[model samples]
Target: MDRFIECWNGLDDPRTGNAALHDFHEILAIAMCAVLCGGQGSVDMGLFAKSKEPFLRGFLRLENGVPSHDTFSRLFRMLDTEQFRAAFQRFMAGFSEQCEGVVAIDGKVLRRSFDSASGKSPLHMVAAWGCEQRLVLAQIATDAKSNEITAVPKLLEMLRLKGTIVTADALNCQRAIAQQIVDQGGDYALALKGNQGTLHDDVVLFLDDPASKAITAEPVVEADHGRIETRTATVATDIAWLNKDHHWPGLAAVGKVERLRETAGKTTSQTAYYLLSAPLTPERFNEVVRSHWGVENRLHWRLDVVMNEDQDRSRLGNGPHNLAVLRHMAINVMQKDGEKGSLRGKFKRASWDEAYLARLLSLF
Candidate 1:
């Protein structure tokens, strides 16, 4: 509890005059604990506080009694989202060391956060997920999906990327972004699509030629759920002529992944391209490419499916972004817990067992 208070002590309270009945950190603490126990919104936070007043008072001082639902809602709606995000980063850093291995950067839209009456669009957040740590390193909310190009650089500024490989989808394959990654002492493997126009076309044309002599890795075949899939990776490090023409920053190699899938006896094939700052072997290239999807499969999917993040209707003020950060904090805490169980099971156990919840809180 002292650690939690110290991490969030710098947040400025939005309340003024006599409106500050409950301590700000106390409200945040309650919200975090409630979320870890599967609480969705302000109402759930209030109910959890009232029900767990005794458990909470063991660490917190309830000088003015438990704060009402309105308090939680109002504070969250008015809180500085940037400050809250920074506090979360600091809190997580206090426990977890600098991230290593593949760091996947991606974006997800909070579908239900849109307000029809107010002409508000769904909130879109671009997050950096540390593949090894299985934690959300940092996130920045964008006004729209297209704004991810601008948001990605800002998100990268918040992380320590030295010696890590940062991967992103084709939409984030900008020269400036690639340069920024190298500038931060990290390498990048960004996907390529028509968005890059001539560059993508040139790579495709060159790799399709027989004389390019790109090294190919052994095909990896998998059978699951009545589907059989095969993936073959090809890498080309002899790109001196290509770099001479393009002058791409840190241009060391180009990669191609050919995926063949058979479902219900129908076969389909797809080819994808990538720009890498490092000249990795075909097998290492395959590993890096496959690990990039962990951001979606492990982090985003868990938040949306397990935590019901998309269904949350928090459209007022900074409520949506702030609540999303709380969900990230909950995931980090649960991921760090050594107990053996699925995340859903942990949520159930934590809510039912106060001792287990205390143990989880002590992990950070």
Candidate 2:
């Protein structure tokens, strides 16, 4: 809590005048706590504050009592989003482990946050997920997925990625983005597609060529959910001949992964190519590829299904983005809580058991 207070105080409060009653720290703390207890928007946060007044008072003074839902909404609307994100990055620095494994960068949309009258599309957020630690290190908001190509560089600048492997989809396969990762002392494994025109075609041609075969590892197979899948990964490091035509910065090697799947009497095969900065074995490349999906299945899916992020109707000002930050904080705390039950169960315990809630929040 002290660390949180420090981060909060570091922010330049956008509010002025005698009209303000609730402390900024108080509102932020209340919102975070409430969300951890399964509270959704400002109304739910206000109610949670009222119910947990005594528990809140244990750490906060609450000189003017709890703020109303309107107060919560208005303050967040005017809050400085960049400052809020910086503060979150500072606060999370305490809990982030050494960033060594795959750090997957992905984007998600706040579906219900669109405002038709104002001509505002849904908010798209790009997040950095630590696959090994199961933590959301940082996030940035963009207007669309195309904007992610630009947002990814800024987002990468906010995180400590030295000695880490960054993975992204085909949308982020830009040469500049890959160069940015390398410049930061980090390695990249970016997905390749026809978006790069001849570069993609050349790699596909090389991997398909019988003479270019320089196999590094064996294929991995899996069977589950009434389906059997096979993945064969190979790395080609001798790109000197190809480099004469397309000069990619820090391009150590190119990778190819072939997937074969059979389910319900249907069989399909697909091949994916990647640009690599790390000289990885086929086995390691396969692991990194699989870990990239963790951001989708673990973070995005959980937010939509368990945290109900897409259903949230808080699009005013900073409300949607700020609330999303709170959700990320709540998830980090809950995941670190070491509870044997599911996330929904943790929310239930936090709501029903103040002592349990205290224990959970303390982990933050």
The candidate that wins on lDDT is 1
* lDDT string, candidate 1, 183-267, tens digits: 9999999999999999999999988888997999999998989999899999999999889989999989999999999999799
Give the winner by TM-score: 1
Distance from true location, Cα of 338 in model 2, Å? 3.1
Question: Model 2 TM-score?
Answer: 0.95
Residue pairs with colliding backbones in model 2 are none
Query: Which lDDT value does model 2 have at 79?
Result: 85
